[model samples]
Target: MTNTIIEFKNVTKQYDNDSPVLDHVSFEIERGKFYTLLGPSGCGKTTILRLIAGFTEASVGDIYFDGKKMNDVPANKRQVNTVFQDYALFPHLNVFENVAFGLRIKKLKESVIKQKVQEALTFVNLAGYENREIREMSGGQRQRVAIARAIVNEPEVILLDEPLSALDLKLRTEMQYELRELQRRLGITFIFVTHDQEEALAMSDEIFVLNRGKIQQSGTPIDIYDEPINRFVADFIGESNIVEGRMIEDYLVEFVGGRFECVDQGLNPNEAVEIVIRPEDLEITTKERGKLKVKVDSQLFRGVHYEISCYDEDQNEWLVHSTKKANVGDEIGLYFDPEAIHVMRFGESEADFDRRLEAYDHGDAHEQ
Candidate 1:
């Protein structure tokens, strides 16, 4: 059976005399999935997390948990726990006491609190460190402690607000794997907030990309990365070579003073559009054997591949990642298959974008 753990309906949050921090945001989170609210700072990622955790009430609209309205639910009454960026463990308390804090507040039996705390600590792989003070733990260890404390309460959902942002790169990467594994083993919903695209793409079952208090897109990582809805999404998710173009027909597009075949449809004839081609999708070859000819402006060795920058006759810059080496000022040809091209409309909402994609897919299926 499908289970939706959280739902937001036209949620808007505002402060006095200020613009709304979250503007009519609406989405749903299914049970036992890892979801990432991804965006830059002040993009409402944290705001959504706060709303879910009941840290703050939405200024307008309904919030629901498990088919129940939660607009007036207090943080303590909600079936969710939060792990903050700072860890938030009591400095004076040992790991055991910290993990047992919530259980103790409920006046649970000491035996019950002890068992729950031990289980939570073991789940986080901190089994033997229960007696250690919070100050004695490393950053990653303390993070695990915070997670342990939250899990001990046995909440149905865990909200993490940039919890790994304070760790060093190596530790952060390690914890990312550990956290994902923990969530899988626990079989509870996890809602993580972050501005780091790599973190979101690497860990999330689904990602909601936000900007300016609005969600630009929400899909699996591969979907958002490979088929961004607009220039903002394309640029923010990863490196993309975007250029203005016109849709000549269902399968034809025009750009860089040349007409090319693409694999997109459902656009008005001669409609202005933008084309996105990832750097890794382009292949470098001899001018006569290539689809687009350009002069190489520069190249950078990026370990896996060389990032080559080239400009066409129309002075449109194209970035390509290729294993082949090319010198500056060298005239080279770039080749790409029709399927590598992604066409995007300007200011298209996610709903409209999905409809267009559905139509395109339907058309393809009918032809077959």
Candidate 2:
């Protein structure tokens, strides 16, 4: 049996006279997994988080938690806790009292609050900092305190609203690992909201890519990165080399003034499509032996690899990540495998795109 912890059924959020913030969005979140709502500003990712946290109500759909309707449930009544972006710590209180505030509000015994606060602090690796004031703590430490406060409440779901956005790059990366490990240890559902693609990809068990008040795609990080449903998803999830193309036939496509073999099929003859190839997949080689000849337009060292940009005869730019550096304006050959090409049809709905891709994938599996 699948343990679905949260379900959003055609949820929409609209205010007086304004357009819907979330337009008929529907998705299911399973228990004990890290999920991320990822998108740029005004994309409604935060709106979905607010709805789930009971901070805001959905305008046009039902929300369910553990098989119970939550449309009218109060925020305090819901079994969810939130860690806001700013950490929301109390400057006047010490760490212990800040963490104990919720328990104190619940009128728990003083001894019980003390024990739970201690345990929570220890859980977040802040056992000895209970006496420290919030102002004395570092950004990462205060963030942990916010988490400790949430976990001390024993909520079934934890919502993180871009909590690491304020930290330095190194600390943010460290917290990413810490957050993932903490979720696993606690064995509860964690809904993380972030606009950072790398953070989402690193921390989420699954990711929902949102845009224009709708989810463009949802899947495991690998699945979303490798098989984006459309041009927006392809461009948003990671660095992609997208180009206009035409599907010549099953397992074949034409792009960059040349025909190439791909794994996509079931499209109408001569249908216009877009092709995606990751920069890491393109190889640099001699022009005479390469599949495509291009001149190095620019190059930059990206610490781990050289980000080389090349332009083919038709002026279509191809971005490649390679270990070898190339001189500017030099002609170079690029090689790519047939399987690297992914054809996306123009104007296909997300459902239709997913269905067609799944069908063709199953057919390929059967043949093998």
Among these predicted structures, which one has the highest lDDT? 2
The lDDT values for all models are 0.90, 0.91
TM-score of each prediction = 0.93, 0.94
C-alpha RMSD of each candidate structure in angstroms: 3.2, 2.9
Quote the lDDT for 226 in model 2: 82
lDDT of 1 by residue, 62-166 (tens): 999999999998888999999999988899899999999999899999999889999998899999998998889999999999999999998999999999999
For candidate 2, the 10 contiguous residues with the lowest summed lDDT are 359-368
TM-score of 1: 0.93
Model 2 Cα lDDT, one tens digit per residue, 114-228: 9999999999999999899999999999999999999999999999999999999999999999999999999999999999999999999999998989877778898788878
Pairs that collide in candidate 2 are: none
Return the clash pairs for model 1, or none: none
Best by TM-score: 2
**Cα deviation of 360, candidate 2, in Å:** 12
